[model samples]
Target chain A: MTGSVLAGFPATTIRWRDQLDTPAVVVDLDIVERNLRRGAEFAASASVDFRPHIKTHKIPALARAQLELGACGITAQKVSEAEIMADAGLDDILISFNILGRTKLQRLRALAERVRLRTVADNATVIDGLSSAFSGTPDRLGVLVELDGALKRCGVPTVEHAMDHARKVDRAAGLRFDGFMIYPAPDHWQDALTFLAACKDAALQAGLDPRVLSTGGSPDMVKFAPDANVTEYRAGSYIYNDRALVSMGGASVSDCALTVHATVVSTPTPTRAIIDAGSKSLSSDLFGLSGFGMVRNRSDADIFALSEEHGHIEFADGAPAVGDHIAIIPNHACVVSNLTDHVQFVRGDYWVGEQRVEARGTVQ
Target chain B: MTGSVLAGFPATTIRWRDQLDTPAVVVDLDIVERNLRRGAEFAASASVDFRPHIKTHKIPALARAQLELGACGITAQKVSEAEIMADAGLDDILISFNILGRTKLQRLRALAERVRLRTVADNATVIDGLSSAFSGTPDRLGVLVELDGALKRCGVPTVEHAMDHARKVDRAAGLRFDGFMIYPAPDHWQDALTFLAACKDAALQAGLDPRVLSTGGSPDMVKFAPDANVTEYRAGSYIYNDRALVSMGGASVSDCALTVHATVVSTPTPTRAIIDAGSKSLSSDLFGLSGFGMVRNRSDADIFALSEEHGHIEFADGAPAVGDHIAIIPNHACVVSNLTDHVQFVRGDYWVGEQRVEARGTVQ
Candidate 1:
């Protein structure tokens, strides 16, 4: 249970296909390396520092690869995931979520000791928590004032709130007001930049030395420009583009590095076929995709329904037979990465090795 | 990592909260035991052979509890789950899925040697795989022909297909055609029973002995009558009934045993609060519920949106503050059970112990 399952996998017809069971996750190193290189190129062309959010693929190897490809650091949502990446020898990290609670903050404080740690504080509670955790520490932790963007999930709602939070973080004993973080930069990147610029101007006028303005949206990352004023970008799903990315013109279908290789278990109706991947395997994160997932090489099939262990595919043109292997590009690659313990690695169609989903099921 | 995370859990004013990290899964043992006892009592009154599906909990202790409460056996959806239960000393287990592929079949054969292994077959491919795996064995393995119900995910489509598959299973070497299986026995379970009876009539007319008809739907299982002709009832979600069940009037909120304890990390807006639990903790499965989950105690807060690590809860009246602890009963419990390695066990508000989710990520 602790190690990679290298043996007892079902055999595949492809000469070097790893015998991973159905609903097996496979990450093609070819596409991954290419995607990483392209991301670096995009960042260099845009004059923005690249720091991938490790929440996409928690594999330590991928984080190392990103650093080797000129990534400044990595972003994680949890202290536990950051701890894993830290243990893997990535020195710089930014936990993008609001780090709250005593246990998490205590762990965050310890993590700060080992790495160049930075985190975001959208509200006063988070700032206060950080202040308590690091008040007496030798090195103050860096805090980014998270500004609300298109996603509307987290962050300060307005420049007024942002200014207040930034000032609060700066006044905190154990924190440094380092930068700004605008998440899901959206297609309207210019609008976000305008807001960020307003926030930055306020910070500068208030005599605050804001070091970076980190912004990210996988679809908008490539559209970023030098005058965008964002010094750093964090993209989680860019490396393993999924169906959502392809549809949004973020990446091509072939650019998808991770795919679920599922076997058709039942052809219940003439138009309906059941695959082995379901919500448990391929997550139920539709993320605006019309279906559960997009089947590779089967444009006619629609993965219409999903249960715990079955994905129903309805097709008119391509009749699937039971035991037929199919590849699926999930809607969101990040959620899929968190499902399996380890993903089978492949180069093209040939099985190479396995990369463990190193930080999977890390609750904290 | 194999053992329970018993250290460094944040202290709570509530004694013995098990200190599981936020986005922690805590199942109430009192409710679980009551649920188990009620399920046994239902089986006795309904006059059906009880086989609680371990797919819901996938905890060996829960399976043993079910057996201790008079369950003739336990039902699992995957061979690997059955293998895990077998390792836990559960002898009679029915894997109620089409077990296909070479490795799965070989493992199924190995599992049959240790337990009274049973499975279902909806197609010729699955039947052939079973025959190939079990052929030359001393004893025949039990197989129930799956009849497609309202779920339309899997199962033989028609009575003829069910009879044909059942006869094929009977003819195959080292295979015994035990009964029928209809999934999602709907509100109109009589219709599914009608279909099962038709398939049974065909088998009986062909001089075949169909001993049991396994019908299961968490909601409809209670509506089942003694005259259902179904000798076996396999209810998966009855143990930890979720929001879906509560919404469907299958069970009340108090009947739900599993609840996610998450802390409010951000109150970004007056009406919106963000919790640490998200798609990674409470799965993105919206089984007809409007939002991600229903918040416990706070009836006003609507968990409307969920990202990978943040659940955005919007409330008009709650005015939730940051650092507030909220328990959410997810829309679906089975998917949540798979997202965690182990769950905290409690009697009520006080955490007592932990139970390892023994068969999580079992691909086969």
Candidate 2:
């Protein structure tokens, strides 16, 4: 049986890959550093503070490498995640999520005391909760007014509503209206830039200091122009491209650093084979794509379906035999980090070691 | 804010529920016990060995409860998962997936010494590995020949092939051909029973004992007839029903014991709101269903889309307001267990403390 699409890696890496336990997540540090350097260079050219979201890797070491590569700060989606990063010595973090509830607010308050922390608020309820917990604190929490740009998931629907929330944030106790943020949708750059400009103009007219205009979505990071209105870009999936990112026009498969290593456990039919990887290993996030993931270097084969412990593969010819190890590039890279407890890191000819996903399930 | 769909519970449970952090998985002990008893009673009536799959909860406590409630053994989907259960003192485990690779086979050998461990193998390659690892041991490893009856996954395709594999297991050293296993598809019980009967007759004619004729898949277990040929039934998702189960006619919404606790984080528009629970929390298993999950007690709202940390809700008349707490029965409950580190167990008036998911990502 052929080794893998990564069969071209160093013989040491190749042999090491073959020896790994099946259904393993392998992250190539060589590719990771290359992707990080590219993102840092792009951010430098665009004059935006690059805050690489740690949701992709969830490893403190990778977060530190992102910072060392020129990110001003990092972006965490949950307070629990930000707390983990803070415990690992990451000082500056922008939790690009709405912080709510009393117990979580107190913990968020504690987290803010330990780091240069910031968060987003799209409604008065969240702002009120943050105010109640942090009103008497010495350091006011930085708040970013999230706008309902093209994504339209969690943000104020209109600029008027956004300005209203911005003003409310400005007047709220123990909270400073630091900036604007949006997890903008890809393929709508013109409308997104327009929305950001209008929000910035409205903030200026209201005599508010809108210091940061952050826009993010990894696919559009490639289109960031020199004169783009946003001051920061948060790209989570850029560091490890997946089929979603590649199909979304962000990066090619060659740039993807992470892959799920699996073994062919069965060939049920002449044209179909089964791999040990499934929804638990390669997550079941389909980006309107045809299959769950792509087998490395096998355009003739694609993973068709995934049960809890088995991945069904349909091939044109030469179905892989049982016991042949294969590597799969999952549809989404961010959630893959959450599915596994640890990820193996490999350099050119040596095993860098395994890193536990520090925030694997830090949903809260 | 209205408390939750669980508002009908005692004031203590409601108060305790309100105190929980958002995006938490709350498992009702009352409902869990009820579901366990129902599954056990059904299996008893069918005269089959009830081996509840721990892949649903991944908690040793739940597995113990299932065993105490009449489950002869427990079903673990992977060898790593079985190892965790064994470490937790589960005396008998059936890893219903194929066991392959050197490292995993070695661990399986060690686990067999600790517990009565049985596993399924569909091909000669897997049987060869198991035989090599267990040869010369005092206790031969139990092997179940799997037939691809309906759920065309991890099983041999034809009865002839299954007989061949069964004979191979009988002849293989240090391995006992214990039974035949099939994860049959629902709504096709007649064909499934025919296939099972054919395989059983073939084993008898070949002068081998297929002691345990196992047919599983929770959906079809509901239709277990009095004359069902199977000796054991392995049901994984019967413990915690989800939207997929309820919609598939295997369960009802009231039978679902687990719900994701989330707070309305934003009302972006009159018809749409966003909740703190997203794919990271609720998971993204659609199972041909329209939405991600159902908002408890609110027919007016359903979650339509999910981002990494945002759930988009589309509502009709009374859209949920910001800060309102709601519970969501996920599309699939098993995957939800795998997504979180701990699950909050609650009874009528008591808030059972959270239990860590012992093997949340035991997909080796």
Candidate 3:
């Protein structure tokens, strides 16, 4: 109510006597800027254009921060999300997911009219649907064939399927076959490169140039360079390292920009404590994690379980007394961001500002 | 943008055309009302007051609707949530979470001054903290001793510890003893009830009447009702059936008032389809569930994996085509509601409206 602990207020500006509400989300802008610079520098060193995925933060201010730090573009997973960024003046978006449904396709076409929009598809049916939806449109729509690396979620299983989809995409008049896209499975860079080479061979056989090969995944981005046949990097969540990223040795807790600032509400026993943040704020995606997530300062504590609004913490060292506020780097950053409308930005001891999660609730 | 799909609209006017969007959450108001009425009626039939916990929906409108349907008071898990609901002019709130920290306690004392605020504490430290914060204040802060069930989370482990803390709270000048509160562990209801009774006996031994006996849970509500020991019910998620509740046979999918409407983006193979609704929209809390969640109408299919913004559905019954929409009942409705800003409402083929998740970011 006092707006004292609101996001973006400089921590240095507050008196030590001021109270900090528990279960609040805290974002370190210094770490966030460093992370952005590090990721952009990595892409620059690899000779690939850095187009950070905005889905992780879903805040226009953060997107602008990435662009100001030299990001070539931004990637979105939905037309509605893209529209949200586009409204905030972010153009050149690569929609990472396949766009379907007449209503959604209509929205995407409208968005393409406002911004340079690119998307992915793994089959001819989707391409045909896009073609039908964009008939008589003069704006060029970039198309990418998604490749499967180690994760078996989306994309074509093999290079042949990728080529088949690419060729079919080429055959569609309203759609342009630009290149290939792959969401790497568990940081398997070697498999992804091998798959990309196969895609190049198939494209060559079909007499098409796969000029815009995009490979993305924060875990495997370091191993992926231009020589690996990747021309663009679409890594997201790198600006805010999470527990999964830290466990995979991609980033450290110090590099984690976003943290759930939870207070110890109850210390029922010497070994147990409960925090106010739960599955809702911290998220339930384990990402193959051993526990709930990583807690800063209290690394010995394990998050045993999360109810809707309460998190059960088990510590081996000592239980945190009631009123202690601890930082938690979630298992996944993107999902955590989706649960809130805004986050506070802090610099060292100063909490300087706040930013709304502008693209939140754009579910369409 | 069409008002039909926009977030924060009132729920009395949604349209059928909005279902084309993937991963959009929907709540059935009729079923929700039915669930509320049934729960309140059952509580009345058993001669108990129903204090419907609003932590599940986090919407003041929904909480107001519940109050109109016979709920004694609304339950909140955070001071910020209670403050927001109170700001909306709704009073008689029970802050169900343990209050900690100086800044937070100051805020809690401020809140107690505004409404009939009641809260729980499990330790002597918190009781002393509250006493210090509310020193010299004439307002009475009702204090409940949170007793441990089989959950092993927050609460006093033994009856002696509970009574000892209760006596300390009774001696506090600014706080009033208000009985006991327990979040009963599923399958351990009888034992917890017996422990609570023993704690009450100890309270009586200390010359205190623990008149307020609050016990409730989505999984164990039915089991706890017959014991006649719990004088108040504090259930929340029973209003919206989720995978966990459905699996526990607490409510059916038809009784489920919450669902995510997702568009099928890709049908790459006969056995696989990708949807727009993923963990960001539907949350990944399986609650020991076998899959991510359950898809309605497409019962044979399985929602197996989520990648931030994409849900992978595997089916031997053949793939859903691109552009098709499907409904999903998340494993945990409370977490899913926390993921988005609002939900669409529908009734018998008629598109009704939208409702804002008023308490979405009230982490404190």
Candidate 4:
């Protein structure tokens, strides 16, 4: 709000940890490092490639830290994000989402020229678009067939359908047939493993080498290890476990690195108090969860609803007074990271600095 | 997604309207102008001050246009937003929400020095905060006692409680009691009117002058005119009536000036199709609506679900093919504006330019 640019931490000798502007996303750097190491250690123990999805934090420094912690590469959901990461010197990147249209394809081709870029496709339409865009380019685009294991958001419906798309990529002059990409639900890990194995077999029978079987989900990754079917694992929200991760038994609340630091701006009644954080900050991504978000360390209170800039909380007793700060664990942390331009980094109540969400608003 | 900045419309001779990137918020400039003029005229005929909430569009040019078309000033929900408008040379502004904390109070005091600013408070704590922040300043801060008519998100619960806060503002060193502010639901307009009158009477009896009785709601504003109890009206979403407004009979589908222009990326089945517009673009504000969004001109289809970057649509019969553009009327336009950084401005079928959402991410 001040006309002055947000220049990291304030220059005052006083600690600014407790004086952060309300409705700000505060990251616990200690938990973030622990999460990064935990994911990397797990993938190393399983002897599989770890590609941390940068779409979660969207912080270039965090991605570099992940790489330094032994991650093979980073994954992005949009080409604009990959472009930003590439500019940040993250050369090895995989855009996990499908790319369409000439504008996005041109951007994708430019990104492919700068990085070891791999993209996913589930249909021939997208494969053809990629082929047309990268045919004359020097770098052959790595195109993986997206398989619909359980999350029916995007991807081919069946293994045979994925094989069809894989064959199309194999036949395209400018495309290289990467194995497959599947984001499985927690309960569908077995199905994802089975379908991915079938895809690998189908590609081998068609004389195409299936190099990377990329499958990932934060919850499923916690339950199932990377097996022979999956050559690499991709997970984003594990970097900042949220309430959704806790509900899915992926991690405890202690593992949550990201918390929205909000102030109780109004205690309108005996039971109701309003925080400054709202859907615009915490986001409306319920992810099948119940309330808007969970008040950290305040199990007695409920963030029942949210308007654009107000979070309505109801307390059982001892409601927070105005000017009190409350830490809120949002339902989904990835969306929250995308909502803000910068996040305050902290280390055990000590303010470290502010990290720019470099990939925020990179929605293609 | 392109690395190149969105240089307004493309300079090439080729038509760029059909080639626009997917999942872009496109505003019909003609309809925007018409909606602005209509709202201003309605407020004028009703003989009440029109303070359009800038949270809906967040574009400074549109806010300036509203002021030129007889809007008295602008209303913002956050101090950060008011700062942006004030930076754009809007002198008269009302931040219609509670402000707390030294960080925000310092910013508020700085903003008050540059503009004629008014803020709302429902609790004594907030009034005290404002009083302490402005006691020594040359400018007296205008404080409005927010009343809880029906929207219990924030505000004092009773007229007497509001009068108590008004008296506190009157007694404060550098604060002026500026009547009351109430955002009522459509069904509670009568209650809001009655409560405002009671508060006004109570303040007058307490030897305080209630100058501004600001009552606002887009749905209620369409059905009820500002009467003697209310001196001004504030409505934001009326400028770009969304699906929630259409369902409430506030505006017809044709009156919606804002539409998310998205591309059908995939048709995985006979009845199911996927669009590029997802929660990041169209937003997840159902506002009690059934679906995430309504596909314009395709009433038979429903945007039933959304992932982070994909909208799932199921058709009754026909399905859109890949690369087809669909205009989606989001459940709420204000959140969508906050989601995107730029809105494609269009005139009928012709692409005009891009409007920067200057107030986007101003959720301090």
Candidate 5:
């Protein structure tokens, strides 16, 4: 508990194991390593290249650990995140979102020059932006056509649109069409495999070699068939399964590695208790869950709501007393990682150290 | 659009107004000043002291501007945030949240020693912790008893509990019972006023002076009676009115000072378009609103959902084409301000400068 103060506040680095602070993200090192090994083994058994997304942990140490555990590369949703991994000496990265504008393109080119950088595109405009930026570059940027498997957030709608974008990438200068990248919804593995197979056939018809058919979602990663057209699997939450993952049947509650350690600050009524962790710490991402998070070992208590700095917990039986510490598995782990600057690492019953969320707040 | 690269990524500074980047928070400086003036004028006309919460705009420059425009003092919700403001030379800060534990109490004492720091406590344990930390210290910490007006998040439940905490603060060593602070829900102003009057009467009967009666909520601040018992009003979102404020009938859409500028990245279907600003950029704080955010000047579009890095916009009419920039008024602006490291400042139509969210992640 003795550490130097940071900005007139308690140092985030906790030294004592017994005096765990409230509203701190605590990662069980043993569980995290086990989760990483399990994911790598599953991908290996299926003969798929494992590429864990750094967007989940956002910690360079954990990214390096994943690479050492047989991950082929790392996946990032933003170019800024890729740069952070690059600074941490992770050479291979995939920016799995469409990036636009001249300023972003110039930065992407610079990042590509520094690392084995690949990007995803679903339309001609984004492809044009990438192609124009990398037209005269020494290192050709690897491009992956993003196809909408089920989630219609950001991807080409049909196989024809995917092939069209792939063809554009294939014909463009200073760009190498790697393959197709699809993030499918849960239980849509058959549809995703079918789409990938058709996309591979379209690439062959167009005389383009589709080397990487990357597809993944934590819920379906372990369910992928060995003979599927997918060549690489990308999963972020597998390293630290959340309540959302557990609710989706991706992992058992025992497999959840990260927990928001919060102290109950108020017990206003028999059924209601307020925890120190709020939306600022636990995040407001429901991820289709009924509540904000799940209280570990306290199934009777439900974290039903959250304000900016207070989480409301409703108990089925009796509420926790004030000053009682409770561990919460947040609804979405990735958003929680993005919300904090550091996380406490716990080994067994002792807090070993703190990991800096280096890639946090890199929204641009 | 030319700025020095930051960690191999494009700097989040907008050089030209026309070339402003997407997925950025743009603050209308003129509108912000007007909002500040309007709020200060409203509080002044009611003879109530105005204390704007820094949780809305974490930037110290904006906080100083608010102080310059007649804000009595600044309010912070966390000890870490108060420390940041103290570092920026804000002399008076009221941390309007119950702080517990040895580490936080020590930090609170240090902050109080440096500045005129007052904190809220609803229970005796918290007051005891504060008293123990401040015992034998030169500066006594001002303590406010929090009353639960309507929000059951963090406050004393009944009048008896309020008086009990107030008496505890009055008798505690190295503590000054300043007054009462209550965050009343909209339309519950009468109840809060009555509660404050009762507390004031109790304090007088106990031979103690209740000098400050602090009550605030942006939605109901405009409806406070001139002769109300509230001596001061605290508000955060009034400085930069948001969609939630508009929906609550607090401010007009034209009066909103903050807007999230995002680029249309995808138009997968006729009715579906995706913006680059997702939960990471705009945040997922619905604040009782129907959607994630309101697309400014585009009533035809509804930002119904968000992923980690993309916003799903369902359009009633024709959607905006790819690469088009759209302004979004987020449901909760405070959460949006906390998500980003920096925000773009706009004066009229020109890009002026960038303001760093200094207290962005100070959520301890």
Candidate 6:
């Protein structure tokens, strides 16, 4: 018989079957709500405005749920994502990134008309552009001076640089200087705090009130929060702890909210098992992870290699038999969500069935 | 402003108005046709049957084009993929993977009732499973022994081991031993040739005529084709060359057909620019790539880092200004295709516009 006839495997089963589907995305919603409330409660307990970032969870539904629970507002990076949230009535949004170009600025203006929109700037050029577009316009835009600590990704490296941008923002018309923003490097808490303190002193010297000081990375959340100086805690992925975070000892496997359902397609030997979920589904985004991800309940197994559509699981112990389904908690949850159009949310066992990753693949 | 919000900044326009309504798996039809022809022609010139593997490009329309161009049939990894092709009325399929478990065997039995199917077996247990399932069946199963040349992925390591499996298949009821199958390791042409020679001797020793000696792998296709010993050639990625293939000097940037359409969202620094295509859109699958992908036309720029929702492009010469649209050829095209439901196909000047990745996220 030809292979074509034998290969009529099912995608409908993934969409409809109670179980036995290969390469499926699963999320634990109960853990997600708990993760949301934890961050919001932490913000309330710390006595600061809790503007939860929606970038981690792009689903507008999740963003709405967070706002309903106690989030001050939602945060977005792209005008597209922000627009989606705003369209869904997430009116108070901080673009959180520099808004540039006439096209984006016009979109931002439209968004500002419906919401209290703010963006971050590390230099005077961006501030000038913001001022040039919005000056004498009815819509007001809030600008935050980005102070970089050790993370060389973005922002001004020092308090002096941050203050210079802050002064320029204060002088620029239609641009409101709202305070400071900093994305700390891994395990550099003391340095981030020191930079924040310096920014506070520089802002006071510049005669501008620094209202908000935000810091959050799911890994460093516990260490940075409860500080009298830090204003808000913005942590996502705690809602869906992945292998990377689990490896860092940030969260337990039981707390993880997302997992990939994959079937063992080939058990070539006693050591290597080829899985249906490869770089495409489970994702090859390893954040210093030893493997692609960890198979839940199978600690000894390692996802050593990945082809485009196949994951090669190497086990020093024993390989999984062909047709056996393995649940993989990815190294990162957000990327996984973005790859799938929808993810199935199940309450108990895998056979318990599906729900939509309603926000899956919402890159725009 | 929260860090999550700051990170959510979309570098490009999120025009919901321009959104494609129905979810579809998009193909750059022009490139796909070119890739298919190139592969088919390559096989024809080499005097080998072009059994273009349908695993990479799963769409039936593409397969039809390949078959019309003189492809012997198609090689499928999953039963579902084969089933789709079968529904499209194309027969002659070789399922490249080992078939296991009773549920899968039952499915195979049903598939055999429809079309010509050949399957590979690396061990005796799998051969037994196949024989037991099709004992009284009229449709004989063509069985090939998977040989491990150098990739060490699947297959038996030695010729003796492969012959052992082949013997089992020959002894099994309603099963016919075809020949041998080898997936060569990258840059290991000499080792592959040596193994193939050994396989030839082993097949003759086992008193079986090696009519169809199959050797596949895109990277080493040229190395194997010139030898004329291999009867069948299976190559998939040559249709859509990715960043990793380009890096290997196997294909040129022009030959690389697929690209991710992205916009510059955050210009945090003069050197660092953030794009709207993050790991979700761009994917974190590097395949030994230095970064995520190549920003088409920007030779000096390197996508050095990627977060779940952010792609960090470090420009050695100059950064892209915010709002600039950039095209990125990902490290792995197949995985990237699996990530998105559709991709816009643009001709020389974007005149061709966008198309849906119709079977994009079919993991089941």
lDDT of 5 by residue, B1-364 (tens): 1221111222334554577877789888778877877887888887888899999999888888777777889999999999999999999999998889888888898888789888989877788888999889887889999998777777887778888888899889999999899888767878888889888888888887788899988887677667557888889999899998998889999889899988888888878889888999888888888889999888988888899889999999988888888999999999999899999877667676777889998867
- Candidate 5 TM-score to native: 0.95
Provide backbone clash counts, one per model.
0, 0, 28, 0, 1, 35
Docking class of 4: medium
lDDT of 6 at B72: 90
The lDDT for every candidate, in the order shown, is 0.85, 0.86, 0.80, 0.86, 0.85, 0.72
Q: Compare candidates 1 and 4 on DockQ and give the better one.
A: 1
What i-RMS does each candidate reach, in Å?
Answer: 1.1, 1.1, 1.8, 1.2, 1.2, 4.9
Candidate 5 segments whose C-alpha is farther than 4 A from its true place: A1-17, B1-15
The value of fnat for model 6 is 0.48
**Model 2 CA lDDT for position A163:** 95
**Candidate 5 CAPRI grade:** medium
User: Which 10 residues in a row give candidate 4 chain B its minimum summed lDDT?
Assistant: B1-10
**Higher lDDT: candidate 3 or 6?**
3
| TM value for model 6 | 0.82
lDDT, model 1, position B86: 96
- What are the models' TM-scores? 0.95, 0.95, 0.93, 0.95, 0.95, 0.82
List candidate 2 segments past 4 Å from native.
A1-14, B1-14
Candidate 3: segments with Cα more than 4 A from true spot: A1-19, B1-20, B225-228
Q: What lDDT tens digits, residue by residue, belong to model 1 across residues A1-364?
A: 2222222223334644446678789887778878888888888898888999998999887887788778999999899999999999989999999988878988999899899999999988889999999999999999999988867588887899999999999999989999798885456677788878888889999999788898887888767788556889889888899999999888999899999989899988778889888888889999877999898898998988898888988987855899988999999999998989889877776776666899998888
- Between the candidate structures 3 and 6, which one is better when assessed by TM-score? 3
Residue B228 lDDT in model 4? Answer: 88
Candidate closer to the true structure by TM-score (higher is better), 1 or 5? 1
Tens-digit lDDT track of model 6 for A1-364: 1112101211232333343556778775666656666666666776767777776667777777777767778777667778888887888887766666566777777788888888888766678888988898785688888777565456787677888898999889998888888777777767887788788877877789887776666776555446655675566667677887877777788878888888776666788888778776877778887888989888789889877567888877898777677899898877777666667765444232344454456544
- The sequence of per-residue lDDT tens digits that candidate 5 reaches over residues A1-364 is 1221111222334444468766799888778878887887898798999999989999888888888778999999988899999999999999998999887898898888878889989888898899999998887888999988788788787889988888889899989999999998777778888899999998989899889999988988667768558899999999999998898888998899999988888777778888888999988998777889999888898787888889998989899777788889999999999999889877667666777899998877
- A295 Cα displacement, candidate 6 (Å): 3.2
